[model samples]
Target: MDYRESLSTGPEGSMQAHQVSHFFSAVDVARRGRWDDDALRQLAHLAIPEGLLGPRGNLVRADVTLAQARWYLEGLVDYAAFEQDESLRFGRLALQLWQALVAQNPQIPRDELHEVALKLATVAWSEVRARRIRHRARMTLDTRRTLWFRELDPRCYLCGYKFTAGARDRFLRRSRSPLTPPPLVDFTRPRTKERHLLIEIDHMQAVAEGGTNELDNLSLACGWCNIVKGRRGSIFDVDSRPIGMLDHPTLGWLSVPQPMWVLRIVSMRGRCEHPSGCSANLANSELLVAPYSSRGALNPANTLVFCGEHDPWKDERLISRTLVV
Candidate 1:
């Protein structure tokens, strides 16, 4: 029997499954979108091949032929017909298409172009293989998601909007399939609308930016916020800082490092991270979690929270030991 993927239904789950495979070619594979914000309003119909997101209905991206792009890629490396590795096939194709799109921008050095192209290609491969990747570790993924959902039915870590449970289940279900285009929901309406009410979990650190699946690297997000936040990925930020911000309730405004930096800043809400139950409050503010020595970059995988009293930073020896490098 032949198998095929299905498009999302209009909230009814009755969409017919066609063996449709779209040939996506883009002028900006990484979606650099390098124009002024006003360009969106002023030039809505422009097709910026060098530095923009989509073709703006001009289909600037769709014009590139995948076969021609593949030929260009073959010029760069040893041509491999019927390459056994699926990732190798798709990734190089993505790179070639990026090169083809950037043909007019000859000022970009080939080395720099190749580096960025590979980064973008890697993201595509991760998403394309997300189902298979998750299936390999589905048990662990589901367990973490289940436990995470049980604790938070309150507020979005990013926007501080209070919501109900079950979004975890919804998001997990959605993750099992290919990425879907958002519904034609008008976001300008009230926050209580169906789109605004849906909550989804997001990576505190992006996959393209070397973020892992550790607990510290995950946070709850409203459906809309997650889409807006995760849209550009880390392709824009060179320093690993998130381009998104959170207008928190008590904190006024906070930079969304993990979408839940508000909660993380308080060090597990001012409690000790001890394995055994400890009534001690985290008063010292200075906290520590390991995989310690990095080249000036913090790793969210080993992040921990604590309140004020546990001044772990005071211990010069413990601090030194935690530094792996």
Candidate 2:
């Protein structure tokens, strides 16, 4: 039967069965000592398109692609030693092709690709987690301390209480002073069971969940919040309401009672300010001042909103001249 006809006539479950059957048959051939350049090339022809292409010759649905990738990788996880390596080779090739498909198709949402990558990374979950921890540890003590204080303001991002100086000093000494001898403790004070400020660098998306170790993925959270948010992803429980006001430099605190969601969509889709307002849509624009940073911290101080065409960050002079004034 033609591939297209097979796809249409067979139920979805049956189509998936055919795909898996073809995949494992290819894998089994590789298991037998037939795994070679020509063998792999032929298998690639069968597997890559079967995994990626839909009945209409376009990429498969994101959900279908994700499911197939997960199924194949799970199979790799169970393989015996020699077979495991060959299966891994096949899995990596499949992933590379999927990535290429994502790149070629503008309609494909990148988030779906990221989700797939995250799933594949789970095959070596412990290694990825360890690597991420090591990567974070490799940051200079000074850099880490600076980022902690600057980004977190000596306070927990989740809870607003300021970290005590003693707590801060102890944290710095323990975390940064790797070479120095441990500081002597003063046992005299009646140590009440107060919550000492213990800060942790958290991955907002989590390393195990395919979050990168990039600075953009890192954020400050107290030990309490970090522990609570462990591996389940960020807990955005904090209120995001716009406090019914905006602090304009010239206008002072104007009572702008619009909800943040309304403002964000309005900024993206709203008309320009020119007398004969340009018809160009700013639907894809970011807020001049993001309500939240990419790392997920709220930024109420980000008062200036802008469309894609009029980015405040790009035009520093415009920000100073117009927004500041």
Candidate 3:
């Protein structure tokens, strides 16, 4: 942590700032010193945020095998740092140092960071030195594996190990260029509208039974259908056309084929959710209106959209419709 001895004036000699080169040299000396965990912890706490540490406390953990610490430090330098005026030999040396550490680190096992950087640097150098042969396939696979783990669950389904979200995001941003856009609907839409519409995608077929994960398999169901279908194949009749299920995305209150009667009902009633077991009380006049009528059909296309819940007094009615249906 005390870098006083590590400091020296540059060639012009006016109290030279410690360059990354100087920091790395000091770190090598520190790694050789017999510093306890408490001393290492203090060094990490003081050094990292100021950008003195390479990243992930790699320099501070002197007890860690030299090979492992070097891998992380090397991986930290990417295209942006590569663009700087630093020597090209520096990058090459850093990666080589990391590879040496990987071969040497026993306490801290070689992790994915080492594997990726080694592969990428190897391919990059080969392309530059060996007549530009295409060797990006391995790099692409590694990148894809990184992305899948980010989007999918982090812990291995078979084995449990914590994965960092920050690491995933960094990998995604670097590997895929601009990361994939956020979800389709922004959750921050204003609540003041007359009817706030909630779009939920219901799978046409349950994914558990050979259904592919794609946009086509998705259908926008209103909040009611989304809640009702939770984690189970929705109830469908003998023809395989879903019964007791709303065609949420494509046909709102009516079937996908578009029944004329249902469409007319939906046009007047907005999206209707006749909660299960509620016999249509034709006697209730207040319940049947622009955003809350029971007359809408079960098709996806005819389903209503953008209707915010406006009337406070009718909150009970809205919940009943969406939840029970």
Candidate 4:
């Protein structure tokens, strides 16, 4: 194929063009049933670059030429017989293309390349797998939440806190007594450990590095773990270090007593109260206060806890009931 049209202007343009030319030449050689190691070696040589570092020596996105080279290498491998040495040769060439891409962009982790190369070498690519991967990528946030909850249950995978229905109510009741003053959790305090009951859908493999949305690649993580795992290969890489308390105007550095369960509720549904009543026994409803947001806008003060039952007054008649906590 005439791949010259894929060329673009850059400091590496000329060198990349030469590499593409050599790659196509090798494709022609392979098509003619000629076993030429010298030509293949030249192809491999094209895969290696010399001191062509990207800006700030950081791994940037692969250029058009590199993308084209990778595509062609994958095609060549697919066309070759898996059991034949030619197939292995093309696979190695494809692997080298990724290496060259990474070499130029140091920010791209080598493990990512290794993972991709292994898949290519094994001819593990399939239409079904691709479709599944794409589907996962396209899944809505709500759908992901449903799927994660159904598959893993409501407890967090990391901290093992069961964040099931009514779990928050139980936690709230246990933290304080009816005769005593309501206990307050300090929201400003730095969370030293994972809040097990506040669950989040975490991408075990980050989507940035081509991680699929498949269930196997997804995990139920607590809010703390998800934030700490940001873009890293695994959660283990993150140090279990304590975060310092953040100072806030309403919530002082260490004096504010914000309940953990209340914070979890707020995080899940901002400023919205559960309609089932804040009382322990009546706290079984998932329904929040009607017109969750006020005046087509978010008003933090409007948020109140309510039971799951629909509020006929507010929902149907548009009359809101104020709950005095």
Q: Of the candidates shown, which would achieve the greatest TM-score relative to the real structure?
A: 2
| TM-score, ranked from best to worst | 2, 1, 4, 3
**Tens digit of per-residue lDDT, candidate 3, span 1-325:** 3455444323332233455555455556557664666435434543322332212122223323543533454454443334343355445744764666666565565675476557656644432332222122232435445434433334211111123343344433443232222233211111121111233334545443334335455433333233434443311211223234332332244222222222223223333234433332212211222222235432332232222233222332222122222
Better of 1 and 3 by lDDT: 1
After the best TM-score superposition of candidate 4, give how far the Cα of residue 282 lies from its true spot, in angstroms: 29
Measured over all alpha carbons after superposition, the RMSD of each candidate to the real structure, in angstroms, is 22.3, 20.6, 25.5, 22.0
In candidate 2, list every pair of residues with a backbone clash.
Answer: 288-306
TM-score of each model, paired residue for residue: 0.27, 0.29, 0.16, 0.26
Selected candidate, larger TM-score, 2 vs 4: 2
The TM-score between candidate 2 and the true structure equals 0.29
**Model with the higher lDDT, candidate 2 or 4:** 2
Per-model lDDT: 0.41, 0.42, 0.35, 0.40
Residue 123 accuracy (lDDT) in model 1? 52
Instruction: Please report how far candidate 4 places residue 292 from its true position, in Å.
Output: 47
State how far residue 275 of model 4 sits from its true place (Å): 44
Ranking by lDDT: 2, 1, 4, 3
Cα misplacement distance, residue 86 of candidate 4 (Å): 25
**Model 2 misplaced regions, further than 4 Å:** 1-136, 174-196, 234-325
* TM-score pick, better of 2 and 3: 2
